[model samples]
Target chain A: GAGVSQTPSNKVTEKGKYVELRCDPISGHTALYWYRQSLGQGPEFLIYFQGTGAADDSGLPNDRFFAVRPEGSVSTLKIQRTERGDSAVYLCASSDGQRETQYFGPGTRLLVL
Target chain B: AQSVTQLDSHVSVSEGTPVLLRCNYSSSYSPSLFWYVQHPNKGLQLLLKYTSAATLVKGINGFEAEFKKSETSFHLTKPSAHMSDAAEYFCVVSLRSNDYKLSFGAGTTVTVRA
Candidate 1:
């Protein structure tokens, strides 16, 4: 079975720029989640989607961070006005349903200079 | 609020020796517990999970975990540590609801010495 996959394994962008990280969930998965892992720290929750709507976005840091899963199979995490502090690994995961075990993607390493 | 604590930040064990990684969780309700391992420069991988059905859960790579409600602990153990077991291990807790949120611990780095 194919696992969750994230595109642009590594991304480098200047501050104040916009970048989009893409995630392709496993086939038949209805739940997707996004998280960020800083250096020497565990992953922190960001946002989650069930079907085509975001079930929870409370973990999102601010308005500059946004995510969308339009068709439910793929998702895109958009960051506006990126900051140097945003330099971290952005990870995506997908599950068959809510409350189920999540399968994670390799992640996209974002670097803001 | 739900939270997880990995008592040890790092654990060093020799190959062929027993390995133990302690984790304690706090939750208002009966929570779902999981063990995930991440190798260097790799994504998180699910090792095992406890969803109230069983107390002793077995996972891949000869790894296992025991969920103790009396102590609010879920400790991962391996009978014999292998050199490949060197990685960062995380303990996560999620409320048993439709919410897709997970509380992660600081993680314990296992260093298996040969």
Candidate 2:
């Protein structure tokens, strides 16, 4: 009965550092997604996984943003050489499948200084 | 290529008054539409969704939306506003051809007054 969950609800990092945000999808969910929401803006898709493999990662802004879902139940979004411009909320969501309604987690607020 | 637009940046209504939030979407093919609500410090919650089965879709907490293909609109409506309804609302669209990736609007902030 648990919903999607994200760890460390808030993360403050310095520029040029590395960070990893974790997401634990709902039990039995096969599809997972990651998005970023800038202040005063809607969330934008970053990547999606339909099991252990990433089905799409075109939304990743650059090579610095990468994600992995090795076991299909949990996913980690990794960022390298973070910049102040990367300060935003990183959201995670999961669904039964691609066509199903996606449920969201509370999100990790990343503040890069 | 697909996008969603929420017409109003903010809407304020007295409690018990009718509420309306307008949204429009553009897509190259048939799309799945949804409305999501996010209260302060809370996760996004699905209010309702329309996947092309019915033009009028009913959602939780006395809310509903009608999908109008002719006008490219999917406006949310509630008969009466409540204090608990004050929050941020987003209009989202996803395309089957594009692997159901959601494209969200900027969002509408609603304020309810007693």
- Which has the greatest lDDT? 2
- Mind giving the per-residue lDDT tens digits that candidate 1 earns over A2-82? 889999999999999999999999999999999999887789999999999998999999999999999989999999999
Residue-level lDDT for A29 in candidate 1: 98
Report how far off residue B61 is in candidate 2 (Å). 0.5
Fnat of each candidate:
0.77, 0.79
Off by over 4 Å in 2: none
* B24-93: candidate 2 lDDT, tens digit per residue: 9999999989999999988899999998898999999999999999999999999999999999999999
Q: Calculate DockQ per candidate and list them.
A: 0.76, 0.82
- Model 1 Cα lDDT, one tens digit per residue, B1-114: 899999999999999999999999999998999999999877799999999987999999999999999999999999999999999999999888734788889999999999
Q: Which candidate number would show the highest DockQ if scored against the true structure?
A: 2
Question: What is each predicted model's overall lDDT from 0 to 1?
Answer: 0.94, 0.95
Most TM-score-accurate candidate: 2
Query: Which sections of candidate 1 miss by over 4 Å?
Result: none
Q: Lowest summed-lDDT stretch of 10 residues in model 2 chain B?
A: B93-102
